[model samples]
Target: MGCAHGKCCNRDSSTSDEHSGHHQRGIRPYKNKDGLTQRSLELVHVPSHNFTLQYSSLTQHGYYPDTTDRENQDSFCIKTQIQGNPNVHFFGVFDGHGQYGAHCSNFVKDKLVEILSSDPTLLDDPLKAYNSAFLATNSELRDSEIDDALSGTTAITVLVVGDTLYVANVGDSRAVIAVKDGDRILAEDLSVDQTPFRKDEYDRVKLFGARVLSVDQVEGLKDPDIQHWGDEESHGGDPPRLWVPNGMYPGTAFTRSVGDSTAEKIGVIAVPEISIVRLTPSHLFFVVASDGVFEFLSSQTVVNMATAKVSYTLDFNACLLQNNATAYKDPSDACTAIAGDSYKRWLELENRTDDITIIIVQIKGLSNQSVVGTTDSEVHSRPCQTGGSMNQSAAIVPPLMHQKPLESVGHSSCSFLSLYIYIYLSHLFFIHCATRLVDLPYTWFLCFATCVIFFIVVPAYIQPLGEESSYYLCFLMIFFSK
Candidate 1:
């Protein structure tokens, strides 16, 4: 692992002394004073002082070695209590590609935070700050001797300020949130993947006179007789890649990235799409990872794994009461498990593995202090839903048409339809209560009469119909439950 500015911060003096042996054994942080002056070390354990935050992060080397003598070209950083701002927290994962990518990622990891923290504007307009920081970092890299023409990194960063979360990304690295929705946990992508496949990216690069082509398309230029090609056809069906016309240099898969001066001439810019969402009681946890993990797994898979492996349990009543502390859970266990699983999955591939990095951040839930006394029977007494059965009182909506497993679909669609339905129904219920029942005069009585007929009277009228009338019963149950 490479450190920012070639220095790691050790919390314990004894640990620093212990690591001196490793330094002697040729595994020490470098003393690179060029470019960024700020220092950062890999695998530094940073705990929170203000909030109950438990997080874990890890990085692994890739299967193929680069000119830098290291296979991994990824870097990450976690900082809590930002400049004494207890509500402010930061998490970042940078995935580097090209020859000098390691140095590029490390440089950004060290300097970007320093620039954001020192600048006063970040507090007023976070989006502007994020944008400026990216441009500044890229500008610095261009002036530095790190060879931005041959090296660049994808940046995905999350800034949590009180209840607001601002995610900014300029590359394929992703940030996703796991939200609690009634009986199930839902996953929401906070950052957009800026690959050549995205229409906006493709258009932007085309405007800059760049050609998005596959290796097969470039090869087809040699054989004009080739009649037609599939949309995504490439070298063995590889994804279409960005390239500069008349040059075979900087064949990057992603459209937006930092410190790629060579690609910039051909329209690869570092502008990030900033995503903002408020942290609510329903918000569970979020994960920030490099493309290595996402290449093999979907966002929902990452969310499910993180939610299950998290050390804290989700408290239903606590969430309803808006007592996030009770629902809060630490993510150290989750992060560790995800890192191991990510590496394992990568190893399962036959050819090679990319650099794997994962950072799991707990959102609304605080870490569990300790288990006290016996487990609550009331909490554990609820019957879990079985795979084969649906509650008779509930609607009998048929299952999805496709019975194939998630693996069959390559995990592209992680069953987000269920999440969409839950959101849509909740929104409808709220809209009815707010616009119809509360504001309309005398309409409340009409609505009540309708509810009574649909829920109470209709159910009584159909109870004796038995299995033959299940479809109608389910229809009645939908309104009744609402």
Candidate 2:
């Protein structure tokens, strides 16, 4: 419905100055290690900022809903130390499909950190590094056969540098940044869902003119190409219109993504533009949450919830109230301090909620705030109003307090590890049972060996980092299975 009259979400992307040199670096390149290829990692440090950061994820039915994870593949996480880079940290969501998000996670979890620090030039141009990594990963996928193609995963990662937050995404996975000044504003949408009708997705669809037609508009793809003559003056070229079946829209579903190469050639879509934004204290908080969380709540509601937390406190404990008042001297319970019940509003406001995942990030900002719920229409609308200073109506915020790091006086690191281990054990047990809901084929089981081998090459330093001539045994397995 967005591009009915044509004018898809197109961008020159040139006029806008790319803060970090935008000279089309070669597509991302990848070199596999012995037993692995793609990987992602996370690094967080407290450089005198009051905040609590955490992340959680859940799938449709707990990974492959058809297999017993206890005896098979499982999801993983890696935390690495960046010697010189203290403020630079990484957070990623590698969502695997077909088999499970584990393999995809494995491939990227191990490499994300190394790639970012690989170049001495990274600090000067993280965007270049970001683009290269994506191209590098996609290039590796090109070598695998079609079956492996179906096994591809989407990636969404965030990096926080003081006040600036950058995100690079591939596929449907997404990233959200919530800011709090006086009021809450969705500072930026690091990534779009890649759904067909979204404005920015228009050009990608028009690019896929006839191929989608060959599939016969089964999904949302259909006959496009309408003359978009805007008074024959303002606009001239043939504006691409959304094609439909029975002359109706909603024919094709996804327009752009990583694994949809099969659709890209038929004039379907192209890769998505990496999204970026810098943060300020004006907004209350920033949440790098996933769609599961967004699907249920509007950005403003999230801000309001955080703000109400501050307004009510209106007063600080005598001892700590002194110079720093932004958060509880202890930030872990920051959310608890702000929202007494912890997003209780989500339950009452949203139409629905999935595995709500969020990273509660605290920054410098004003104290006056709003209490918006997930259902607030304005919050659900464009959470972040684009362009810079023009958004004055939004809450004007200044850092409320100076900062201080919490002192873990007698905390035992081992105890924390043990607690997490126990919790993870319980989660794994439940996920194992939940996986039985989806029916998988015998081929998926039989090709396990081949699948293992293919995944193994993802992280190792294999040459070319782009194309490959290998289509091993699993290639044959794909044909037999179908």
Candidate 3:
């Protein structure tokens, strides 16, 4: 959200070896002012942009949270311009308090795209809007005393425009896009997992002189009785610690997030570094999911299942090829195969740590959907294979034939004018709310109303305003101009 600092463009430090991930357009790996590749990630498209889209989500209270402070949230969004319209279909998962399933139940509703397209500027500078939204929520919670010592959720949100998709995130929720390079990794990550894994997070702890721990370290810290207990009895070692602040582990945890105002003061909460990856033609399916799902399966494992051809509509759950121990769709029912399947679906009440949600997108045929319903829609005969291999047809690649048409896009340009105006006004109103400069319930109402007008009415002014309103005069001018 910060103005372009010309820092992400580390040309002098770029490494272009075929083995390196440098030289990716105007986008090279952006090291935070901290100088680290932990934030460096990439996005790629495969074959061509055409592809089919589908998604499913599930959640359960693993061990307990219906009464505890632990919270979890998992969400993902898929927007396809297949309808070839300006509107975008956005979705998100708002996993809440890890104690029970209560957190994520209504989160999806609260987590929708704020319909800001009405304000082109918000849409254009989504990063700023995103940061504003996060900080704004934190401010509100702190002011209202709504967030005391508990309650927060992790979020994973995705946006797809034409073939370009974007991800913005906070907390531990994650976004992983599959690349189509002969079954290789092509994910240009848009959201850095706000794990305590980064060095800055570690330094921040050191700043407060707090302790840190990966999930594994947490277990080790326990059971002081076991002197020098160096992984002798542990099977998989230790799980990564979810947190590393507040006088705990001294290394890493929590770089940025929401509802953690107290934690921020204590230096546990962090403002996430944003990552933007264009879901071009070369990119294949994208997996925007929660850690719950990851706990049950590896990312590539899910990709293998999702990309396998199926016989049911990729959007439905009944047709999903659950571990049927791994199988393919029947030839005739191929059209009805679920776009992606999940063995780790959230419906199971198995005790654990968090909620599970995932948005799976298939490439190649993803660009447009023409309502393939009714005929053979009920058929879901699983294919006869468990091989998690990429379907050659599902690979995506950005095409030169239909590039993002060139345009003179600038602040003064008509295309950008309306957007920035909307941004300025919306930003002004929120800045007031965020800073509590005019804080009040009444003021809240006013701010909300202003946001509505900016998105809904601004477009009209953008089109031919200031024209004289006279029947005869207008007709004469039109005639003369013609």
Question: What lDDT would each prediction earn against the true structure?
Answer: 0.57, 0.36, 0.37
Total backbone clashes of model 3? 74
The better-scoring model by TM-score among 1 and 3 is 1
Better of 2 and 3 by TM-score: 3
Clashes of each: 2, 53, 74
- lDDT string, candidate 3, 1-482, tens digits: 00011111001111111112112223322211211111111122221233344433333222232424332222233332212223233434443332111222222223233332323445345556555555554454345423323334455666554344546576655666655543233333445556435555546544854444333344455652332323211223232233324433222223455544434554645354555554444455566655555544444455444445323334322122333322222211211122212222333423333334454444445444222212222223121110000002232333223333111112222335444444555455455554563656677777677566645564355433422222233343344433
Reference-based TM-score of each model: 0.60, 0.46, 0.48
Tell me the lDDT of model 1 at 182: 61
| Candidate 2 residue runs with Cα over 4 Å from true position | 1-83, 99-102, 144-146, 183-188, 210-253, 264-272, 302-357, 364-482
Worst 10 residues of 2 by lDDT: 9-18
The alpha-carbon lDDT assigned to residue 235 of candidate 1 equals: 26
**Candidate 3 residue spans exceeding 4 A from truth:** 1-52, 60-87, 98-112, 115-120, 143-145, 183-190, 214-253, 309-353, 364-482
lDDT per residue (tens digit) for residues 156-239 in model 2: 666653334566665445565544333223334456665433555655555545322222222335443322223211222222
In model 3, how large is the Cα lDDT of residue 27? 34
Give the per-residue lDDT digits (tens) of candidate 1, residues 358-451. Answer: 7776643433321112222222111111000010111112222352110111222213443344345444544555465676688777676755
